[model samples]
Target: MNVCTTGCDISSIHLTCGWFSSARLINPRVFKRLRYNDCLVNNGNRLANGHTISFQYANTFRYPLSVSSVRC
Candidate 1:
């Protein structure tokens, strides 16, 4: 699983995976979404496929047209 937080023009991310028998571990933050294959193999071993990954981006706007216009 992954967790993320953002503020203004900057953002941060964290990732972790559950313990497993395999030495390979994926960073949860690296993918905004993911999927797995039902069946696959290579070198007489099961292979991974159909896994999708994505990233989330934050948008920022600079400068204000009128910062004090709405001040009371």
Candidate 2:
């Protein structure tokens, strides 16, 4: 997962994956929409072919988003 909160533009970093994951940004000053494989969310995103994930937030924040959970 990737999170950019320090005025860093994450436009050049191309990410592709074949698993269930989510990327989110908690910054309240960045309004960057995300492009994903499953659907479009304002914050972080997920690229899945036929996977199901969980989400709880609506409405756009700074809008910058994406994340993944590393199971230990």
Q: What TM-score would every model get versus the actual structure?
A: 0.17, 0.18
Model 2 spans with C-alpha error above 4 angstroms? 1-49, 58-62, 67-72
- Model 1, 1-72: lDDT tens digits are 112233222122212211212233434434221212111112112112332234333334321111111101
Best by lDDT: 2
lDDT of 2 by residue, 1-72 (tens): 224344433222222322323255434222222434222222333323333333443443333334322211
Clashes of each: 0, 11
Over 4 Å off, model 1? 1-47, 60-72
Each candidate: RMSD: 20.8, 13.5
